[model samples]
Target: MRYAYYPGCSLQASAKEYDLSLKAVCNRLDIELVELKDWNCCGATPAYTVDPLLAMGLSARNLALAEAEDLSVIVAPCPACYKNLRKAGKALEEDPELREKVNDMLTEHKLDSIPKVKLPLEVIASDFDWDALEVERPLAGLNVACYYGCPVARPKGGFDNREAPQAMHLLVEKLGGQPVPFAYDTKCCGGGIVFTRDEISLDLTAKLLTKAKAAGADCLSVMCPLCHLMLDAYQSQAVRRLDTRFDLPALYFTQLMGLALGLGREELGLERNMVAPFSLLERMGLKV
Candidate 1:
């Protein structure tokens, strides 16, 4: 099950832990990830707001590279990247004139055909045989709140339900972890405005933390790095702003899967998480 892997900008720097854990889990599942060489930024959220064509072209450039690689499917770990790539791919495939315009922007590589853009969750859920994989350490007593944030199940026609996604929940169940009934699973974490309007972002992040904690979730299983950053990295700020205690740990879903698969903490980059899950893991009787 080989697919083109695009780590995007966040995974290389702020979300290295996600990249590490994703690779570890993929390796364990025998899912080969051929990373596209010289892959550029997917333009994330900023470029599209500034100029729609520029955003499409930026994402289309990466798609052109994947087409060159002869891979039918391109899997992006970052939801923002996946959204951009998927949007651009669909636009290009539907409109020939738009494809020509974008191709003109690409001086070096022209997109003959845009590859199918997919989220890491989409690839993992559809490809693997869950029953065959041995679960060395089942997450028996752990309660996880799967957070999709925005962009993950958005823009419609994607893998999961845009309003009510259940892919992460099913994966949690498969890993022997109980998926808590979280109402704000698809809620925005204010990641788009975290830098410019931190007050608003903090308020939103605080609310999410509050809800997840209230739901009795031991930790938040997030798919997007931006969501993880707002929930985990900026949790202290959210706590200070709201004058509340939110000692919740935000972990990548891949990290949880790795732990259940008996992969060590070092391999899954567990130490890189801002909110430490050591105590939580200890409670689960799992080695950290």
Candidate 2:
């Protein structure tokens, strides 16, 4: 019913729509999202490859802070943050040396090992009563392709099935929507290369969206803000670069869930999207 929420850096800036929609949906669903105060970045992209320990340490600090709170789960919206924290948390829990180093770093800031870290989707889809979610709304008619895209389901330590994740599909079914299976569901969205080698990202995203479209997915669902950014924001560029016209709307899993729960477009932050959901809303018969 209640969980500690970490919006991470992307949600605060690039992914603010996700944060807003999540809060609005939680309010509508009577779920409480308690944001952890003074939570810093989950080390973002820079820390990961350069210094793995520093990345873990930074994530550990945030995790330690969240764990200190009286909550067992921290629902992170950003895949980067979720992956970083989840990997760091697993490392801290299983790898004694890594745990000791992280703990020492945490003590430097007067913190302790805190609650476990997880993506909000994972926690909500798994920990909560699935039957209750099914009763909320029927997402059976809507065709959705679930995109895991790197961090959220990787590292093989956290929750959900590693090879073929069905959690999102289960959630989609709970919301009365049909989940369309696709090949690139767990494939990289070309995230890290988005800024540096943008052409590659655009091409990959274009192909991914094309695959989703070809799979008969009316819309794409994702838990990662970065994935949303790549799929939604960069879509136009991808289309331009690849000389193709694919206008499939990308929806945050929370946004679609909120819509199905009888929430309006504004409530679900549909206005902040790069790829307009007007047609999709029309398909869903939702008035904007």
Candidate 3:
């Protein structure tokens, strides 16, 4: 199956590992991710908060590009991008007047409709055929806390469940990894203000770290790049701030999946993680 892919700004810069690993995994499964040409940012919450029309317009522009690609689904790697893109697409399809206004702002002109916006994980979990899928190495003894974070299953009923999400657990089982039932799985991670507001970000991340460790999670498996940044980059600081050492690493889910699918470490960008989980993978006899 093929889908229009949107890497977003974070995937190009901070979260390149996620993009690489996701592509590697999908390629192995014979899934084609045709990137939407000349796509722009989905205009995050702050942008929408400042100017609603501009944010929607920006998101609509990307949708139009994807539509031009003759794609019905757009798989976004970043949670923020997926959330905003879905929001814009849904809003436009529901409101004719607003859709017309947003279309006027687009350079591509008339966008009668928008495609479905979703995360890569959702596609894998819901649609992938388990019978044909191969696992080169089982993720045995790996206790993973599937961190859905905020934007994943938020803003009420869209795609995934808000409180109890089980898709990640099913995937962990498929990969031979134990999915730890971690508290605060859907919690927020202080987002883009980790530097500006260290205390809040640290505290929130600390809560997740502490909970994951307590739940016997070897590491936290995250889908969103921003959540990866907060939990991976600021985790050590959160431990220091909390006066406890939670040495659990934050890993992108695709990284683990790629490893299971027999992809090389370099192919998955495994070493690029802030809190590298290679040691744990190596110890578990997972060939890199």
As for candidate 1, its clashing pairs are none
Predicted structure 1, TM vs. truth: 0.96
Q: Rank the candidates by TM-score, best first.
A: 1, 3, 2
- Candidate 2 local lDDT, 165-274, one digit each (tens): 88888778877788987989988888778989998888899889989999999999988887898999988888777667878889998888887777777777888989
> 2 or 3, which is superior by lDDT?
3
**lDDT tens digits, residue span 1-288, model 3:** 999999999999999999999999999999999998888888776888899999999889888888888898999988789888888888999999999898888776468767988788888977788777698899999999998887656765556777788777778889899998787888888766787887888888888888889899998889888899888877888889877775688888888888888899898998888887777888999857
TM-scores for the candidates: 0.96, 0.89, 0.96
Which of candidates 1 and 2 is the stronger one according to TM-score?
1
Q: Candidate 3's C-alpha lDDT?
A: 0.85
Candidate 2 has a TM-score of 0.89
Model 2 pairs whose backbones collide: 67-114, 67-115, 138-175, 138-176, 139-175, 139-176, 139-177, 140-176, 140-177
Local error of candidate 1 at 273, Å? 0.6
